[model samples]
Structure formats: structure tokens, C-alpha cells
Target: MSVINYGQLLQLAWPEIILTVAALIALAADLLFFRQSALRTRFLVAASIASIGCIAAIFKLLPGSSEGMLLGGVFLSNPATHLVQIALLVIAILTLFLSVDSTFTDHVGEFVLLILLATTGMMFLVASQDLLVIFISLELLSLSVYILAGFDKRSSRSAEAALKYFLFGGMSAAFMLFGFSLLYGFSNSTNLVQIASAIHAVPLNPLVILAIVTTVIGFGFKIAAAPFHFWAPDVYQGAPTPSAAFIASGSKVASFFIFFQVLVIGFAGAEGSATLHHFQSGWVPVIVTVAVASMLLGNLVAITQTSLRRLLAYSAVAHAGYMLLAYVAHSEQSLAALLYYVATYALATLGIFGILTVTEKQLGNDKISDLAGLSRRAPFLSACLFIFVLSLAGIPPLSGFFAKFLLFTAVLAVSPGSKLLIGLIIFAIGMSAVSLYYYLRVLKSAFVADPPADATPIQSPMLLQLVVGLLAAGVVALGCAPDLILNQILKVIHASGL
Candidate 1:
């Protein structure tokens, strides 16, 4: 191992450091203002501090052009890392905005602080190149989320959600750690590059395949892929809306990026080698099966949900399947497609959840019927929600359509002649069509159904309206000119030397 220098490490890790400092400052402020009668003012102060930290981190990340290993190969910093960090921070800021003046106001400072810490962990997770670093960062992210999920101590459902998530997360961590140990035993190193080099020197073994399967299963749960996705709907339904949004967006994005790194870096072998063939053949079938199952099951089950949050939770599972299609293609192009699709999905999802937060606060429930006549009560909110839901359903002239197009195009480009791939593609298309039924069901409730006699117009805060408007505009912009983002994605891919 190379000796590490603290100064250089701090420079490479400036974003995480800034985030940590911000979290600490928020914690101190929370303690100082715990007895303040004006809860809103306290929350705003904390949020402002967190936002400043995020801005500072973004500035630190934007200027760097160097790309190389950091801290003796435990972490990496490249264009891809920078992009993921920026996404995590942006999502964190949005989440903080959503929490303000909402149910989380009672503990707003802690809430924002936890989100900052979780975002920092996500940034580290994406940059990690060592098994130990990945595990530590994942734990940091997961622990903060577990608390955030149950932050509404007054709600039984929230408590139940946190408990279930904790249990499942613990199990997944064990599986992943064991898998990492197995890999280390084989390679005598925790670094991904070294593992790949070591694996290429030996014949394929059952243990190696087992490690791959175990690790993928662990990651499968994180991304809410099928068969391992039973916890998602329950958690999403019960958690605070902003917490659910963060889990669905920031956490999912980081998980997929790290999973991609583990597969492409740790298992890859020399060109034309038996080990490379073995790794590909071993994992491709597993991912394909997971993707197909996630799409079919998630979409089919979502149609029956009357609760808006549960319905979106199942929709998320289906989206996970769509993102996995990129991995099935297993190329740099596919990775770019996955990133673009997730970024678009995150924007739409956060917008919808932001609207839900306001609606839930006004009405005290998230039932599908609760959205009835939303257009009459809050036309702008209704319009934003419509755009987001339509985009999620992959309707034309929206970001979701282009995202799905890129994913399918990437996969088909690689495996055009494979009968299995063709069948899976058709199945995915059918499932996407099925998904439209449920998405439109929500829209119909919002736009066409009658409002209750007691219903009153919604009065959302200006900040939330601004956030939703920006996200909705983003979806439209991406749909109209996907190349704007795709070109940047291409640049990142090239910069990474992949």
C-alpha cells in the first residue's frame, strides 16, 4: 500500500469534509435553538447553513480537472465521481427544501443534518475503489436513512417502516460483507483493481461465482430490484415524504454507480481471457432475470395500490428494472444511459414527492382519492404533478420517454440477435404499457374526479412551488434536448478512460 498524505487526501475529499462540517454546525444550531418557540425560523437557519455547505462543495468539485486514485487507491476522483457528487448534493438540497415547514419542522435541524451526512456518504460510495471503503460509506448512508425514515415518531407506520428497513438492511450488509471477504480471500487485496488483476491470473472457481452472486443480491435489495424488493413499498409508504424521496433518488443513484464499479472493476479480466468470459456469463443471466422480474412484478402489483405513496414505491421498482437494462448491455454506453435515466427519474420523482408533501400536509393523507379535483384546488401544483407522472410513464415529449429510449437503444445495440434479449425487450415494453394505466389513474383522480364538499384550495409555499417548477422544466428540457445532458455524460465517460 502507498503511504497517504493528509493534505492531498483533504484536497481530494473537500466535498465530504465540507458536508461534515455543515452537519456539525447544523447539530450545534439545533441544540442551541431546541427551545425556540418560532420553529420555522430555526429550521430555516439550519437549512440555510446546509445549503451554503452544499454550494461550497459544488464549487470545490467543479474546478478539479485531475482524475486519479486517492488515499492509496481506496478512493477515486474522476469526471464520473464529480457528476455523482453533484447529483447527490442537488438532491440533498431539494430534500432539505421539502422538509422545511412540513412535518419535519419539529426536528428540522437534525433532519437536514442527517441528509447532509447521507449525501456525503453517497459521494464517498461513488468514489470508493476499495471494499472496506464501500462498506463503510454504505453503512453511513444507510444508518442516517434509517433514522430519517422513522423521524415521525408519532406515526406507527413510520416506526414499522424503519424497523423493517433496518432488519433488511442489516441482512443485506452481512451478505455483502461476506462476499467482500470471499473476494479478498481470493485476491489477497481489498482494492478493486488489484482484485481484477489477481482474478485474471487464476482459473474460475465456484467461490468466485458465489461472491459475485451474493454481492449482486445485496445490491439488488439496495436498488429495490425484484424478489429482493418487498421492503420498498412499505418503507416508501410509511417514511416521511422527503425521506422517501431521498431514498428513491440519491441512495438509488449511488447504489447503482457503486454496483457498476464493483462489477466492471473487480470482476473484469484480461481481454479474451477465460476469466473475463466466466465473469460475464455468470452475472449477465442473473441481472437479466432480476430486471425482467422487477418490471413484471412491480408494474403488475402497482396497479392494485390505492395509496399514492405505495403506488409510486412500486413504480420505483419498475424504474429500477429499466435502469438495470443498461447493465445487461454491459458497456460504457450502457453505463451512460443508466446515469442519464436515473438523473431524469430522480428529477421527476422528487417533483412528484414534493407535491405529495404539500398535499399530505394539507389533507393529512396520501390516498389516491385524496388527489381528487386537485386541479381546481391548486392548478399549478396539479399541472406539475401531471407532467411528472406523465414523464414517469414514459409519455412522449418528456424526459422519461427519452430515458427509456436510450436504455433500450443501448441494450439492443449490444445484443440485437439474442432471442432472450429480444423477448425481454418486448416484455419490458408490455410492462411499461401496463404502468401507464396506474399513472393515468392518479392523473384522472387529480384532474377529473369531484372534490369533497369540505375541500379547500391548497396553499403551497413559494419555495416548494419554485422547486417543483424547476424540476418539471428539467423534465421537459431533457425530453426536448436530451443531447444536452447526453453530451456531458459522453464527456465524463471519455474522461474516465473507460
Candidate 2:
């Protein structure tokens, strides 16, 4: 066993420590100094502090930060993990920016504190290579998010969402813990590499298969994949906009990153083929099955939704399916593809939710019809929405398009002439087309439909508008220059020898 190095661990964990300090400071400032301040003023101060802390964390991770393992592999630091941690911080910052004008909760300090805490959990989550660390980090993250979901105490829907999320999360955690215990019993180690070595040496057994299934169940709920995704639509619709945004963005990056690691690293030799008619009994086949269900159910059901958040929830499920395709490939290129796709997809989804935050505040609803004549009332926001929605629908010259292209190409590259994968790609393409219909319904409401006679222009805060615009611009820039982010991801993957 490796000796625990307290000093080295602290050196590697400075970024998370910074964020925790910032969370406490934000909470204290809100309770003591800003309790009587205006909601907007309180939000501004807390958000500024949080943003600055996130910036500090990002700087800590810049190019030359320490990289090593600690606590017998309970903690890990590597270029790839640092890259993901940076992305999580960036998403948290953006979520904070979008929350500055929120009125759902007056407890600005607590809200921001929870966000920071959740982000800290995510940072720890992506930096670990041990099952014990992973489970603990996930619980920390999940607890914080459950509170955030119901932060709007005035709304019963918010409370209900929180209750449902907590219940489902508890069950998933139990399942994941059981799976981890089985893995520990099998390998006598919590370290993923050692677990992989053990798995490689033994024949695939019933207990190993059970562990894989239970582990998948746990992560499936996290990523909002179908069958295990019953909690997502409600949570997305009932939770406060900022909470949903964080769940969809930062939480997703962390969850998917760890999921990839657990499968590709911990279950290395057990990846049975997922190719059509050639399916082997491994994690890949399980993921492929989930992917198919998510794509079909998410797209087909989204077409019937009128609520914008619900539609996006279903869309997220579908996008999760697309993202899962990378796992089917399970190569370094697939890792890069998955990261780029999830990052870009998260940006687009967050931008859409940001638009909802503004429009819902002004119009009093997030129904598709609430956006009627949005172009006439809020042209800039509408234009931003155009970019965001189109990007999400995988329209050309947008980040979503390139993300899908890279992912599909990577999967195809994995098996040069596999008919099953080809068919899956074709089905995914069809679902993308199906997705365009619902997305256009949103655009049609914003651009083509006539406004209510009493409608007035949406008066979004300038800062909020700017943040949303920046997010839309990011989607566009990434799409137009896919290599910009993809190259960075590839560099980290290579540097870590992933």
C-alpha cells in the first residue's frame, strides 16, 4: 500500500480548497453583511465572489499544476483530470452568471454556497481513481444538488422535484455502493487500475456481471439515460432554472468523465463487443442498449411536449444517447470526442435555460407558446436562441453538429466496417432529424407566431443578456472551429497517456 502524503495531497487539491473557502465566504457575507440587501444586490455580490473563486481555481489548474496520486489512489491528479476540472469550474462560472438575476430564492448566499459545494464535489469526482472516493464525491454532489433543486421553497413543484430527486438518488447510490463492494471483494482493492488487473486475470463471472449492471444503473440515472431517467423531466421542469442548468451542465461533465473512467479503466478487458449480431456480454452491449432506448424514447416523446424545459429534458436524454456512442468506441479518440461533445452540448443547453430564465421571468411561463413573437419583442435574445436551438438540433456550422460528426466518425473508426454500428449511426441521424422538428417548434414560436395583444418586450438584465449571448457565441465559435477545443482535449489525453 502507498503511504498517504498529506502535503502532496494538499498541493494537488488547492483548487478545490479555494472553492470551498469561497463558498463559506459567500455564505457568511450573505448572512451577516447582505441579509438586508436587495435581492439583485445580494445575488450580484455572491455571484461575483463565486465567480472570482472559480477564476482562482482555474488559475490553479493552469499548465504547470502538480500531478500525482495520494491516499493510496483515493485521489489522483493528471493533465486529463485537470482539463475536466477546468471545464467544471468554467461551467459553474457560467451558471453563476446566469443566476445573477434569479428571484426564485432570496437565500442568495445559501444558493451560491450550494453551487460551489456541488462544484467542489465534481472537482473531486473527476480527479479520483478509487471507488470509495468516487462514491463519497457523488454523494456530496448529489446532496448539494438535491437542496438546490428545491431552493425555491415557495413552489410546491420545486419541493416535489427535490423529493423525487433525492429518493431516486438514494437508491442509485445504494446500487452503486453494492457494485463497488463487489468489485472491492473481487480485487481486494478500491483502486481502479488494480481492479482492472484483477478482472483481466479472471474469467468473467456472474458477480462481475452484476457489478457492471448495477454500476450502469447508478451512472445511467446520473446522465439521464432512459429507463433510469424517470427523474430528469420533472427535475428539469420543477427545479429552478439555474439549478437545472447546473445539473445539466457541470454535473453532466463530472458524471460522464467518471463513468468513462470506471468502464474504460476499471473494466478494461470486460468490454464485450457491441457490434450488431456480434454483441458480446460486456459493458458496451449494456451501454448500447441504453443508448438505443434513450434515443428512441427521448426524441419520440419530445415531439409531444409543449413545456420548454420538458422538451429540453427529453432532448438532453437524446443527447445523452449520442454521447454514449463514444463509449461504444472506447478509444482515446472516443474520449476526446465524448468530452468535446458533452462540453459543447452542455453550453448549448445552459444557454437555452438562460433564455428560459429571462423569458419566463417576463412572460410568466415557459410554454412554447410563451415565446410567441419573441423575435419582435426581444430580437437579440431571439437571435441568441436561434443559435442555441439550432446548435442543439445539430444544425451545420454549430458546435452540436461538429460534436456529433466527431463522435460518429470516432465510433466508425473503431470498427472500420461494422454493419451494426453503421445502422446505429443511421438511427442516430434519424433521431437528430426528429429532434429538429421539436426544436423548430420552439423557433417557430419565437420567430413566426404572432404575439398576444398585451405582450410587451422582455426586459432582460443587460448582464444576463450578455452572458446568454456569450454562451451562444461560444457554441458558434466551437462549431466553426471544432479543433480549438478538440485539440486541447486530445493534448490532455495524450499527455496522460489515456
Candidate 1: lDDT over CA atoms?
0.86
- Worst 10-residue lDDT window for candidate 2 reads 197-206
For 1-498, candidate 1 gives per-residue lDDT tens digits of 578876777778878999999998987887775546477667777888898999888888783644567754687788888988888899888888777767554877778889998998899999888999999999999999999899888889999999999999999999999889999998899998888877764445778778878888899989999988878988999998889999989999899988988887787752221122344445666787788889988999999999999998899989998888777677888888899999999999999999998999898899999899999999999999999999999998999999998888888888687666577778888999999999999999999999999999999999889989999999999999999889888788878865
Give candidates' CA RMSD values in order. 2.5, 1.1
Residue 181 CA error for candidate 1 (Å)?
Answer: 0.8
Tell me the whole-model lDDT of each prediction, alpha carbons only.
0.86, 0.92
lDDT of 2 at 439: 96
